[model samples]
Target: MQIDLAMLFLTELQVGSERLYKIKRKGTSLNLRYEIDGEIHRRSYLSGLSWRAILLFALTEGKAVTVHEMDQPGRYRKLFPNTLLRRLHWYARPNANFPPVARFYDPNGKAVMLLTRSRVCGHAVDALHNLAHSGPVFQPLWISDIMALRPMLGLDLVRDETFSAAMPISAYLEAAAMMGRIVEEPEFPGLSLTGNPRRLVTPPSSKAGRSIFDQASRENPALEKLRDRTIYADYSLTI
Candidate 1:
């Protein structure tokens, strides 16, 4: 059996270069470890990038790795491709719901699609669970219905004029972190990465409220400026 320390040594050999190596099966499962330097990190293949990349970055650099999961088809194709999957797994199955969707809010608390839905999605929840016990506060924002926002303009979702409803950023992220820690109930027999996968599908807005962006702009001129800058900035310019 390949112990955690041995995996770390193997990963150290592959730093700066990507290589594929098989883990000696321990029992029913294989402990996939990505090691760099003397530090070794282990993750389930099911947990995906957050467990693989984010944790490595955190352990090596002492920085928080920001993870976002998407559920959009258009964006999913652009971000993660089948070629990458082949590199990760001997055989990979694309989830029907690809690009696992996720919503991000600006300072004012409007939801915008950060990731689109696709057939091959990565698991952020499981990654959070592996890293959560280490001390970083996990944050989760429950969007009332992610499907409704699919057609909505990304900009409109971030603003208060169109979508005023939003959860407290800290509260959402922390909850998400906690949710990631939950273990699946064997009796349920379903795929749930974090707390409730359905939370990602819900809508955050109601008929009576304004968009969170508008409210933010009203309260903080700096945020309005940032939004304007983000909206109007040319992509061709190099920072």
Candidate 2:
């Protein structure tokens, strides 16, 4: 990969950019982890901007990639020409479910997004949501998924949010790093890349990057802001 392309991918992904919030009521508190996850999933799936970044990187590199719409069609506009992509059947989503994802496969490897529904669209789908994204399993899953691909390019075309959502993650990275697959590119200052099927890490510039200080990502509601001088949006625990 071109150094600039890699650097651009790292920067554009904005690994540590998400500013999360916690809410406190006058007396009771609200549980928004699932809600937060919903919002995150909704954005990740519906937002064309996110997919554009991923596809753009691959197209720029002239790498052949596939995006499984998972039966949802016309959701992601074609970023490149017809010859570049091989799409599966595009299906309709009548109810418009939350956490719908398109599976991505590129020369680097694939990111298998598990949703509530089965591959063939089973009833009462099983969800990969609600499981702690930053918890024990999710972060390591990224490394394992990439490793299994054994990509030809020594990279994994992962989105920036993958790094962010799984923030404060490292043990798996150290393992990948041990293989000399992970390192910082001198060409791009502050770039920390874990290659051999890349292990996504928050670059130094990310606001949510490794830090000792406590960081708050958002503001409390106007009502809550007025009532309690002490109350601020609590950082979400599950998110």
Candidate 3:
């Protein structure tokens, strides 16, 4: 039996990160603890960015690693061709169904499409409207659908939203690139980098990258701006 070393590592890492969040959120500066191979490990501190870095590291080092989660048990998720899945997976959580989702099924009657949550983009509404008016039944699961399942899977946090909608594929890629994360080849669109994710965390420098942040910033001016009169990345949780 060939063991999946990467998945094993991620499982432990995820547990530890969650523990770290609980400890720090309480204003306690305690080290995170977890067990692996009968050995205990501890970390003085682990920031959210650091947790994401560890995930990226695992992805890059273990290319064949099947990214698994709680929502879709026993299903290995992929990141490419639509990195937006990562965004919805990592950020979107349970909330009041603002901008309610539209539900539909494929012509075969076997597949169903349920529009759930979306990022800041408004295209999800347009897509749902078009699909409802059009005549193609939904299928078992689209790549985006699979990605949307992230939050529901085994996440310890109480979440109200489920990602039933698909965001623009290009937007994910652009966001990933801006974040300095590796862009998987055209065939697979995911974030995988061998080096530190911090290296790629700089502000968007390209024309297209700048455009994305600019639009997002404008749409969420209140949250994107800082009290010091400076603005941060539109999608950044904190500056």
Most accurate candidate by lDDT? 3
Cα-lDDT of candidate 1: 0.26
> In model 3, where is the ten-residue run with the lowest total lDDT?
1-10
Superposition-based RMSD of candidate 3 using all C-alpha atoms, in angstroms: 19.0
Worst 10 residues of 2 by lDDT: 228-237
Ranking by lDDT: 3, 1, 2
Q: Give TM per candidate.
A: 0.17, 0.19, 0.20
lDDT of 3 by residue, 21-131 (tens): 222333322233433334454443333323334333443344322322312333322222134444434433432222223333333322223333333221121112112
Candidate 2 is scored at a TM of 0.19
lDDT of 3: 0.28
Ranking according to TM-score, highest score first = 3, 2, 1
lDDT of 1 by residue, 152-229 (tens): 212213312222213222223234444443222231234323322322111122211223344534764554444322
Between candidates 1 and 3, the one scoring higher on TM-score is 3
Alpha carbon lDDT of each predicted model: 0.26, 0.23, 0.28
- Candidate 2 C-alpha error for residue 175, in Å: 1.8
